[model samples]
Target: MEPMDKDRRVPDRYEPGEGCLTTAVRLPVRIVVLVLVVPVRLVWDALAALGRAAHRTVLRPLGGGLAWLWRTLVVLPVAWTWRTLVVAPLGWLWRTLVVAPLGWLWRTLAVAPAVWLWRYVLTPVGRGIAWLVRGLGVALVWLGKALFVWPWVALWRYVLAPVGRGIGAVVAWLVRYLVVVPARWLYAHVLTPLGRGIAWLVRGLGTVLATLVRWIVVVPLVALWRHVLVPSGRVLAVVVTVVVREVGAAFGHCWRVAGIISRAVGRFLGTVLRWLFVEPVRWVYRTVLTPLGHGIRDGIWRPVRQALRTARETVRQTRRELRRALFGAPREPQPAAAVPPRREPGAPGTRTLGSSTTALTKD
Candidate 1:
């Protein structure tokens, strides 16, 4: 290996050293944070667990049951009633009274006539009316041209146009001398300067007003906002940020602590339950109940079942003897092959005109 240089060295597992301020700050902060967080965390976790348990055990089932009951008892019945009593009757009445009559009337009167009129009567009549109206419109246009448009056109072109031209020339000349020249001169010489002075005064007044408004209203407001309100808001924001950060940190720590506590508690509870209830129950099942069940089975159940079987056999024998004594000994059943009377009757042939099925002919 190269000689280790003072400036260039291989780094190992690096552990950063903490300052005294950090070391002093961390322990008390952690202690204070733990103190603040623990109770809140425990309470929050407990309430949350309780809420979850309640929802699972009580609220969810209750809500489901209520929903089921509502659906079954109220919604189903109401829907059935509405469908059966109201909807069905309304549908029947609508079809029977409203739909049938209106459909028939519409089809018979309105639709049939409308169809006939549209197809046969109205089509030809409307075409004829359109043709007549078109011809009349042409004639009316000719008459209108003669009566109105031609007269106006002639008046404008022949008489009124020349008079209007002469009047326009005179008016233009008079207006140029009387109105236009004087107005242009007044605007250029008098009004322009006066407008410029008025505008300058208005601009100066506007500038003064702007300065006053800036000093009296805007500047102070700006200053107050910048110097006073801004600083205040910043301070409030810092305070709020610090409070929120601490609260957030506390909440996180509390949650972890609470979780640990909750786990410990749960373990303790589990242990207690195991030792107190589960172990005892298990022991009873193993030592007491199992032995008792076996004893009941071996000592009582088996012997009782065997005795019942013997009693049943004795009763069956007694019944058989009583039956034999009462009815005398039962004759043994004869074989069907040995007894011809016990054999089935043969199948009969179909009766015909030549065959007789009477008892007299039967063999």
Candidate 2:
């Protein structure tokens, strides 16, 4: 047997037959597995490569091309056919044949006639109806006015006036008999005496007050103002008047001197300007400008005025001719109907007629 140390030590080299029998056996299996797996993997990889090649070279391009073909040939044509044959024609036909004719017919046959009828016939008829209604309203207003006035007239003429006169006469008689007699008696006896007594008392009191005011207040005030204040006011007024007069004299002398200087300067300036500028300008205007203006007026403005007058006369004559031609000549005025003469109230003929009518009615 080997030593224990040998048993504990790990061996560096393994023997093929002693300890690697299972590895050798597994090696065959591994080789077999490698063989099978490599072939299968190779087949799978080849198949995948073939599929990718087919997709890239054939299928993808075929699908894209087919899609493009379908889009170009089928989709575009179908869309074009639908739009051109169906949509466009149907829309155009609907608009042109149906909608246009219907619109035209509605406008010409229905709408235009309706507008005409409303404008010409219905509008005039409506205006006439409104006018008639207004006239009826006016007539009704007049009837209402008559109805409103009739009762007042009847009441005044038949009932109220007569009753009011009778009442007034009764009231007058009562007032005269009862109130007036008593009032006159009171005035004559009591009121007159009382009024006289009151007047006498008032006059006496007024006289006493006037005398007292005159003696106590008014006379003293008058005396004080006359004796003291009036003299002082007169002295002050005299002083003020003297001062005002002196100042006014000085101002007037200064004003006169200033006026004389201003007038002299103004006269000198006026003489210089008139001789230098004003007289020349005035001469030019009178000689050259006035003659030119007169020549223009005679040559241009006078002719224009004459033409305008002739045109106005022609227009007036044309207007008169048109008026005479369109409307016939004016008719002569007819004499007015003769007015009936008014009969005097007590005329013999009027009395006879009235009496004969009365007799006829009575018979």
Candidate 3:
């Protein structure tokens, strides 16, 4: 790895081969890609800037206002309605009607009956049935052993087993002499060396074919890839890199210029809008409407409001008098005693250079 790294340390990145053909191709390809990529990069940068401006100036505030309006108009109201009309009523109904009745019914009908049946009836019946089943299982097992299992066991152990063993020995002897011995002889004496000879011939032919293919096809292709295509690719890559760098630089310059022009235009538009609409509205609001609204609020609206308030107070006083006359004066409210607020169990003061921070040592 260290040797390979040393060898590759000063490797050429692009333009590895400097030749006439590469030079010719590089010039034209750079010129074309630059021309094409310049306009594309400029347009892309402009559009991207415009998109950012629109998102920042127009879409962002609009989206925030829409979200706020949706929350206020739709989401909050729907949530309140669901909580008030659906969830509250459902919760109340589940508690008052479903839970109470279902709980009572379960306790009265299901629980008591199931418990009684399991304890008083099912337990005794199950035990009796289990005891009977266990006795029958034992008896059946012994009877089956005497009638079926013993006969089969005796027949196999005493009679059929010996016969089967003797027959198996005879068959083994016949198979060894008749089939296995001849097949082994044929494989060892005849087939093995023949297979070896065939394999050797195949290997020799394979070697020749492999050599021919390597020299005819693989070597040429490898040489073409390594010597011709790689150098050409490197030259093309260098041209592409240069073109891209130029285009990127051009895009940076163009984007800066576009932003400057955009800001200038925006300022011009802002000035025009201020003169045409904003100034008149601001002047009118300050000069005319402010005084008029203040006059209306003070002169007429306040007087009417004051009159209504006086009437309300008078009515309230009369009603209070009538209540006092009927119910004999109400008892006065007593004042509450002030109590100190709770103190949490922690150090009250902050620690400084001279103080210890532990709760037990507060100094």
lDDT on C-alpha atoms for all candidate structures: 0.79, 0.75, 0.80
Q: Write the per-residue lDDT of candidate 3 for residues 105-211, one digit (tens) a residue.
A: 99999999999999999999999999999999999999999999999999999999999999999999999999999999999999999999999999999999999
Clashes of each: 0, 0, 0
Model 3 stretches with alpha carbons more than 4 Å out: 1-110, 271-363
Q: Output the lDDT of residue 4, model 1.
A: 20
lDDT of candidate 2 over 1-363, digit per residue (tens):
112343244423334554343344434544444444444444544466568789889999999999999999999999999998999999999999999999999999999999999999999999999999999999999998789988888889999899999999999999999999999999999999999999999999999999999999999999999998999999888666655644454344334433344445546766997999999999999999999999999999999999999999999999999999999778999999997566546543333443445434553
Residue 176 alpha-carbon offset, candidate 1, angstroms = 2.4
Can you list the residue pairs that collide in candidate 2?
none
Cα lDDT for residue 231, candidate 1? 97
Q: In terms of lDDT, which candidate is stronger, 2 or 3?
A: 3
Candidate 2 residues lying further than 4 Å off, grouped into runs, are 1-131, 142-148, 239-363
True lDDT of residue 153, candidate 3: 99
Worst 10 residues of 3 by lDDT: 1-10
Best by the TM-score measure: 3
Please estimate how well model 1 matches the true structure, expressed as its whole-model Cα lDDT: 0.79
Model 2 scores worst on lDDT over the 10 consecutive residues at 1-10
